[model samples]
Target: MSSDFEPILMRNVGVAKAADLQVYEARGGYQGIRKALQMSPEELIDEVKKANLRGRGGAGFPAGMKWSFLPKERKVTYLCVNADESEPPTFNNRVLMESDPHQLLEGIMIAGYATRATVAYIYMRGEFTEPFHILQRALNQAYAAGYFGKKILGSDFSMECYIHRGAGAYVCGEETGLIESLEGKRGWPRIKPPFPAVAGLFAKPTVVNNVETLCCLPHIVLRGAAWFTAIGPQGSFGPKLFCVSGPVNRPGCFEESMNITVKDLIYGSKFAQGMIGNKAVKGVFPGGLSMGVLTGDELEMRMDFDSPRKFGLLGLGTAALVVFNEDTDIRDVLLNVTRFYAMESCGQCTQCREGTGWMYKIAQRISLGAGRREDLDILVETTRNMGMMPGLSICGLPDGAAFPIRTLVEKFRAEFEQHIVRQEPGKVERVLRVLN
Candidate 1:
């Protein structure tokens, strides 16, 4: 099925002759920012709220709600754009940062204006060095053009943005971690009572938004909320950029309507090229490792925030759609993902620090052919308990790290059982070395 999908964030990427300012302005770029400058800050926030745009950085929290959390009376609120796309199999944000830095800049400007923020910062992963340069150049251009700095677009609204690069910790993708890193401190999550909005970034009221979340702001401002809402599903409004990777014939990002079924996305003419190696798809990690795996049966489900929730999985996690063919080992995949969370955990939260490591061990054992059937139950129980741990720990790192273990045990029980039944003598030792 040939797709009629037009790329939004990545529309002129690589194809445009010039990636500089002149080319972007000619193609209707910065119009959103120009329009946003005309509206009152409150009106802009209302528009975004009416659009029903949700955060695209794993958690599906409403973008408007997050912005609304800002204390209106505060004079120095900050909008931190999270560009640290550390989630495995998630590359959608990179597309925006690399291809169309202006889109995100425009979004940041709008978000800053809405929240009465005079300064915005783009906290980017260090690995995105190239994109970082691209964005920095874009910000300079915007400043020169009067889109940034005092009296932006001659509207008395001043916003200045700077790019801060992270040292490549997955935890830094978390809002609090990003804040801590931005403050030049150890990237650890702070305990939340004073959520970022109440007290954040030097203890001032602030709003942290993901890159994609901020990128949607300009569109919301330009088209109006109703128009944006009319494009996608009822609850999930606007177009979504779905990144497909791992063993697909055509592995890349594609923008599509939210309600598109997983089957149509993976097998459609515009994506995947009909599965890897012509093998039957055994499972899919629809929203990266944190969201857990959905088997072939669930792949037919719609690709929306609530669709996977109905199957007991979270679907809005980076919108990463990783396809695993029959040749893939579920145990191995789970083990790798578990190990990642374990290594990345900041050790501030006991449940996350300990539970992630423990889960990784069990998953590694199973992948090495030494898993006992009871171990599967233990993995599930431990993860369930850990996920229930108390304290509103800064960031969802604890819960995010634990969900995969719980979901994997529940969704792929047979795979774990097979590992145990086919245990080979001394295979555990070999697997341990490999895992290490």
Candidate 2:
């Protein structure tokens, strides 16, 4: 893949004082908000609709369509900026907020204006200590610069922005759960019919958008919808920020078009620059740790919203890839993945709580050299029936939990069976070898 494409979201990233308001303004920040302030809310919404800017927060829902869901007669509209980037191996949001705070604020302002939202709350994870301070300072600067106040930039539109730090709950990354936490309640997902666009945040109409999704609005407004749509393939439009981790030569975040393949990301000179030690890839958790894994042979899959489905994945997820070398143990991977979901379940839905626990225990036993062939069947059965896909949970948490475990077991059954088969005399040594 060519590295000639200019990065829109991260254009100012490595520059000196990129997070400073003055530096951001010098680099053409706030141009989008200025342009947006002139347009009618309907017009802005229409522009985004034409641009096809989907939510970057795993759901891939159309941002304009979601904003359009707000009732025309509502008294107040709330905008919730979901800054809780809790998905494992996903830190693109943090990079954006920390590197160019004004850009994110600009995007939030544009989104707030488009949705007719009078107030915006950035629901950030509590653990984001550094980014939080940087964003807070940026918010202060934005307010001081007359970008947020009674009348922004001498325009009739007015909006307020605030940051509400969440106590690092993975479930809160879900919109409704984020809304609940913003209300100072336990972070549990709300049953729908009254989606957030209808009643959210103090029971008022709200729009919850991810950090990266909002960050695209500024570019769309400045360049025009057609320009935005032309970047990537249809249905997966615009530039995407990808995080590649593990034993890659250069494991970090990179902004690229969705047309890039998993293979390209791992081996492209401008991306991960091939796996470390020139080892063959064993498998890849192509979209964070939850979306499911891609076998070494499946590296050619396109890194896009729709392409992952063809290979039995849960969509592009956070577009974060965690690569494992051929020397890695599949059993250890399964156990670690299952354990994360087990520890993170909010204990709300019986299926998710108990089912994740069951999966984790089974994975642990198998990893500890006490595996049986029947355990695999039990794991598969539990995952198949536990998530919203099967009508068993209230939110998509179980679905996220189930996909990786099910896919890992099904795709790497041979590796799992090996663990079970070798659980004899040298089982202790085998387990120790994996642990070390």
After TM-score superposition, the amount by which residue 52's alpha carbon in candidate 1 deviates from its true location, in angstroms, is 0.8
Once model 2 is optimally superposed onto the true structure by TM-score, how far is the C-alpha of residue 396 displaced, in angstroms? 0.2
Total backbone clashes of model 1? Answer: 0
The pairs that clash in candidate 1 are none
Residue range 1-436, candidate 2, lDDT tens digits: 7667899999998999999889999999999999998899999999999999999999899999999999889989999999999999899999999999999999999999999899999999999999999999999989999999898999988999999998979999999999999998999999996999999999999999999999999999999999999999889999999999999999999999999999999999889999888999999999988899999999999998999999999999999999999999898999899999999999999999999998887788787887778889999899899989989888999999999999999999998988778778766556646654
Q: Candidate 1, which segments miss by more than 4 Å at Cα? A: 1-3, 388-394, 425-436
Error of 1 at 389 (Å): 7.0
Candidate 2 Cα lDDT to native: 0.93
Alpha carbon deviation, residue 100, candidate 2 (Å): 0.6
Which ranges in model 2 have alpha carbons more than 4 Å from their true place? Answer: 425-436
Which has the greatest TM-score? 2
RMSD (Å) per prediction = 2.3, 2.8
Residue 143: error of model 1 in Å? Answer: 1.5
